[model samples]
Target: MFLGLDVGTSGVKAILVDAEGEIAAAATTPLSLETPAPGWAEQDPEAWWAASCAAIRDVLARRPSARVEAIGISGQMHSSVFLDQRGAVIRPALLWSDGRTTAECREIVTRAGGEAQLRDWVCNPALEGFTLPKVLWLRNHEPQGFARLAKVLLAKDFVRLRLTGSIATEPSDASGTLMFDPANLRWSREMLDAVGLPLSLMPDVGGSAEVLGRVTPGAGKLARLEPGTPVVGGGADNACGAAGVGAITPGEAVSSWGTSGTVLAATAQPRVDPGLRAHTFCHVAPGVWYVMGVVLSAGGAFAWYRNQCARELAEEARDDILVDEAAAIPPGAEGATFLPYLQGERTPHRDAGLRAAFVGLSLAHSRAHMTRAVLEGVCFALRDSLEILKALGLAPAHLLLTGGGAKNAFIRQLQADVFGLPVTTVNREEGGAYGVALLAAVGAGAFPDLQTAVQRTLARRPPTPPNLDIHRAYEEVYDRFRKRLVAART
Candidate 1:
C-alpha cells in the first residue's frame, strides 16, 4: 500500500492505496482557516502537522503497517511557511487566498518593469495572494520575524520537513511562489533580488516524484508508519488534482469548483495569456506546463446564500427537496444574473473591491430561481477562464470536473451548458491525495513513469454534454454578462 496525504485549506485527508490503484482506507480531519483581518488569511503550521498526523494514524490503524510502502504529500500552493534556525514556525502561514499584500505586489511589479516584465518572467501578473508579496508584507510589517527567517517553504514542503527532516519543494508548488522561474525550473535569483529578498531562505527544488528522504523515527511513531518509509515530493494541490483526474496531455483540462474555482489545462510549452488573465506554471509531469485561471468565489457564494437567505429551507432540504433546490431553477434563471464576486475576483478581472449582486431580479423569481442563479453565476465566471484559454490557443477538448460542488448533478450540467462542452466526472473525488499516492507508487518502483502510472490508475466515466437549446440560450446571456461587466468597470 502507498500513502498519500493532502493538506487542503479546510482539512487534511490521508488515503491508503494498493498496488492496483484501489483505495484500501481513507480518513480526514477538519481544519480551520483564520481571518485575523479583512483580506488576510492565516493558519497555524502546527495545526496542519497535527491534523496530518491524526489522519495518518487513523488510516494506518485500519490497515497493517507492513503493507505501507511509500508516502506522498500534496498541499495548498503559494502559502508562505517561515521556519527559524531551530526549524520552528516563526508565524502563521499566509494562505493562497489571502489578499493583504496589494502594496507589496505593486512594488514587485513596478520593480520588475510593471505588467510586461511580470508577464515575461512569471507568465502571470503579480497578485496579492502570491508568495513574494506575502514575503514582502512580512519584511515591511514584521521585520523581526523576517530577520529570523532561515528557510521559506511552501505548504507541502513544511509538512514534508516534519515527516522527513528535509527542506525541499517540487516544481509545481515552487512555480507558484513568484520567486521561482517557471521557464527555467529553478529559484529566480534576479527576481528575488529585485524584490529585496535573499535566495538563501528558499528550499532546494526537486521534481514531483523525487525521493526527498524517508520518514524519521519520531514521525513514524506518531503516524503509525514504518520507519524509513520513502517519502516522494508531490506537488501543488491543483496540479496533483489535475493529474488525478487524468488531465496530463494537451487538449485536456480539469475544472475544479472548491472554495475557489479554477480551470487547468496541460500543455507541452508554457503559453502566457496576452491579457495576463491566466497563469502558466510547470507541471508535476516533467517537461510539461499547465495554464490555470482562478475565480475568487464559486461554491463559497452558494454556501453564503444557504446560510444567510435560505436557512430554514436548508434545514429541510435533505428530506423535502427531490433535487437540490438550487438545481430546479430553469436556465438563465428567467433573465436574472448574478455577479459571483463576494470575495472579489482573480481571473480576467483582477479587481479586489468587486462586490457581488443579483441583477435583473423580478417579483416573479422564487427561492429556487435565486439559488440556481447563484450556481449559474459561478459557471459564468469560470467560462471567462475558459474563454481566456481559448484565446491563448490552448482550447481543451474535454474537461474533467472535481471538487465538492462538482458532486451536484445540477451544477455539473450547468457547467456543460455554460461552456458548451462535454463534461466528464471521475469516480474518485480524492483527487490530490490519490495523485500523490500515484506519485509515491512511481517513486517506490511500482511504476516506471508518471504517464504509465496515470494510464493504469485513473478511471474515467462517460462524458455528459450540454443540451443544445440551453447552450444556445447561454451563449446570448453570456454576451450580456460580458457587456454588463465592462459597463460596470467603466
Candidate 2:
C-alpha cells in the first residue's frame, strides 16, 4: 500500500492505494482556519500536524494489516510555514487564499526592478497568494517572528518534515513560492537577493517522484506506519491532481472548482504567459510543466450565495442545493449576470480589491433566475482561466471536472455550456490525495510512471457534451458578465 497525504486548507486527507492502484482505505480530518482580520487567512501549523496524524491514523486503524510501502505528500501551494533552527513552527502559516499582502506584492515588484523583471526571475507575477508576499508581510508586521526564521517550508513540506525528518521540496511545490524559478527549476536567488533574504532558508529541491526521505520512527509510531517508509518528494496539490485525473498529456486539463477554481493543463515545456496573466509551474512528472489560471472564488462564491441568499431552501443541509434551485431556470438566467468576484478575481485581472455584483436584474427576474445567474457566473469565472490557457495555445481535448461543484449534474452541464467543451469526471473525486497516491505508487514501484498508475486506477465518466444552441445563447450573457467586471474596475 502507498499512503498519500493532502494537507489542504479545509482538511487533511489520507488515502491508501494498493499495488493495482485501487484504494484500500481513505480518511479526511477537518482543519481550522482563522481569518483574524479581513483578507488574512492563517492556520496554526500545529493544527495541520495534528490533523494529518489523525487522518493517517484513522486510515491505518481501519486497515491495520495493510503494509504501507511508501508515502507521498501534496498540499495547498505557496503557503508559508516559518521554522526556527530547531524546526519549530515560529508562527501560524499564512495560506494561499490569504489576500492581505497587496502592499507587499507591490513592494516585491519595485524591489525586483519592475513587474517584467520579477516575471523574468520567477516566471510568475507577485500575487498575494504566493509565499514571498507572505514572507514580506511577516517581515514588516512580525519582525520578532521574522528574527527566528531559519527555514521556510511550503504547506506539505512542513508536514513532511514532521513525518520524514527531511527538509526538502520538489520542483512543483517550489515553483509556486514566487521565490523559485519555474523555468530553471530552482530557488530564485535574484528575487531572494532583491528581497534581502538568504538562500539557505530554501530547502533542497528534488523531483516529485523521487524518494526524498524515510518516515521517522517517531512519526511512524504516531501514525501506525512502518518506520523507514520511503517518502517521495511529492508535489503541489494541482500537479498531483492532474496526475490523478490522467491529465498528464498535453492538450488535457483539469477544471477544479474547490474553494478556489483552477484550469490546469500539462504542457511539453515550461511555458509562461508573456503578459503574466497565467502561471507556469513544474509538473509532478519530470520534463513536464503546466500553465494554470485561477479564479479566487468558485464554489466559494456559491457558498456565499447559499448562506447569504438561500435561507429559504428546503434542503439547507445540502450545500449544492442552490444549483438545484437554479436548475429550474434555463440558460443565460434570462439576461441576468453575476460578477462572482466576492473574494476578488485572479485569472485575467489580478485585482484583490474587486467585489461581486449581479447585473441586469429586473422585477421580472425570479429568485431562481438570480440563483442560476450565480451558477453561470461561477462557470463564467472559470471560463476566464480556460480562455487564458487557450490563448497560450493549449486546446484541451476535454476537461476533467473535480471538486464538490462537479457533484451536481446541473452544474456539470452548466460548465460544459459555459466553456463550450465536453466535460467528464473520474470515478474517484479524491482530488489531491488520490493524485499523490499515484506518486507514492510510482515511488513504491507499484507502477513505473504516473500515466500507467492513473490508467490502472482511475476510470472516467461519460462525457457531458455541450448543447451548441444553449452555448451560443450564453455567449451574450457571458459578455455581459465580462462587461460588468470591466465596468466594476472603473
Candidate 3:
C-alpha cells in the first residue's frame, strides 16, 4: 500500500492506495483558519500537526494489517511557516489567501527595479499570495519574531519537517514562492537579495517524486507508521490535483473550484505570461512546468451566499437547493451578473484591492436570480483564466473539472457553456491526496512513470459539450461583465 497525504487550506486528508492504483481507504480531518486581523489569514502550525496526526491514524486504523510501502505529501502552496534553529514553529503560519502583504509585495517590485524586471527575474508578478511578501511582513511587523526565525518552509514542507526531521522542498511548491527561478529550477539569489534575506533561509530543493527522507521515530509513534518509512517529496496542491485527474500531457488541464477557482495546464517549458497575468510553475514531474490562473473566490463565494444571504434555504443542510432553484432561471441571470472577488483576485488584473459586486439587480429579481447570478459569475471568472491561457498558447483540449463545485450538474454544464469547451469529471473527486498517492506509488516502484500511473489509475466520464445557443448568450453577458470590471477599476 502507498499513502498520499495532503495538507490543504481547509483540512488534512490521507488516502491509501494499493499496488494496482486502486484506493483502499481514505480519511480527512477538518481545519479552521484564523483571521486575526482584516486581510490576514492564518492557522497554528500545531493545529496542522495535530490534524495531520489524527488523519493519518484514522487511515491507518482502516485495514490495520496493510503495510504502507511509501508515503508522499502535497499541500497548499506559498504559505509561509517560519521555524527556529531547533525546528520549532515560530508563530501561526500565514495562508496563501491572506491579503496583508500588499505593501510588502510592492516593496519587492521596487527592490527588483520594476515590475518588468521582477518578471524577468522570477517569471511571476509580485502578488500578496506569494511567500516573499509574507516573510518581509514578518520582518517589518514582528522584529522580535523575525530574529528567532532560522528557516522558512512552505505549507507541506513544514509538515514534512515534523514527520522526517528534515528541511526540504520540491520544485512545484517552490516555484510559487516568488523566490525560486523557475527556468533554472533553483532559488533566485537576486530575489533573495532584493528581499534583504539570505539564501540559507530557504530549504533544499528536490524532485517532487524523489524520496526525501524517512519517517522519524518520534512521528512514527503518533502516526502509527514504522520508523524509516520512505517519504517522497510531493508537490503543490494544484499540480498534484492535475496529476489526480490524469492531466499530465501538455494539452490537458484541470479546472478546480475549492475555496478558489483555478485553471492549470501542463506545459513542456516555462510559459510565462508576457503581461504577468498567469503563473508558470514547475510540474510535479521533471522536464516540464504548469501554468495556472486563479480566481480568489469560487465555491467560497457560493458558501458565503449560503451562509449570509440564503440561510433560510440551508435548514436541512440542503443548501444545494440554491443551485436547484437557480437552474430554473434563464441564461445570464436575466441581466444580473455577480463578481466572485470577495477576497480580491489573481490572474488578469492581479489586483488585491478589487472587491465583489452584483450588478443589474432590480425589484423583479428574486433570491433564485441571485443564486443563478452567483454560479454564472464564478464560471465567468474561470473563463477569464481560460482566455488568458489561450493567449499564452497553452489551451487545453478539454477541461477536467474537480472539487465540490463540480458535483453540481447545472454548474458543470454552465461552465461548459461559458468556456465553450468540453468539460468532464473523473470518477474520483479525492483531489490532491489521490494525486500524490500516485506519486508515492511511482516512488515505491509500483509504476514506472507518471503518465503510465495516470492511465492506469484515473478514468474520465463522457464530455459535456457546450450549448451553442447558451454559449452565444453568455458571450454577451461576459462582454458586459468585462466592461463592468474595467469601469469599476477606473
The top-ranked prediction according to TM-score is: 3
Clashing pairs in 3: none
lDDT of each: 0.84, 0.87, 0.88
Per-residue lDDT over 1-490 for candidate 3, one digit per residue giving the tens place of the 0 to 100 score: 9999999877899989998877899999999988887667898887888889899999989979989899999998889999989988898998888888899998998899998877777889999999999999999999999999999998888888999988999999999999999999999999999878999999999878889989999999999988999889999999998888888878788899988889988888888888889998998878878889999888888888878887665477656688888999999889888987777788777887777898899999998999999998888898899999998888787899988767878888999999999899987788889889989888888898888998887889999999989999889999988888853343
Query: Clashes per prediction?
Result: 0, 0, 0
After superposition, the stretches of candidate 3 with alpha carbons farther than 4 Å from their true spots are 313-316, 486-490
Ranking by TM-score: 3, 2, 1
Stretches off by above 4 angstroms in model 2 are 311-317, 362-367, 486-490
Ranking by lDDT: 3, 2, 1
Error of 1 at 65 (Å): 5.8
TM-score of 2: 0.95
Give TM-scores for every candidate, taking all chains together and pairing residue i with residue i.
0.95, 0.95, 0.97
Give candidate 2's root-mean-square deviation (CA, Å).
1.8
| 465 Cα displacement, candidate 1 (Å) | 0.9
**Of the candidates shown, which would achieve the greatest lDDT relative to the real structure?**
3
Give per-residue CA lDDT, model 1, range 1-490, as digits (tens).
Answer: 9999999888899999999888889999988989897667899999999999999988888886537889999998888998899999999999888888888888998888778877767666788778888888889999999999889898888889999999999889988988888887878877887877788889898778889979999998988777899999998988888888877777789899877889988988888788888888888888889999998787677766777776556475631352366566778778778888776678988876566888788999987778777788888999999988988887888789988656777677888889999898776778889889989999999999888888888778888898889999998888867666743332
lDDT of 2 by residue, 347-389 (tens): 8898877778888899999878988988888889888889888
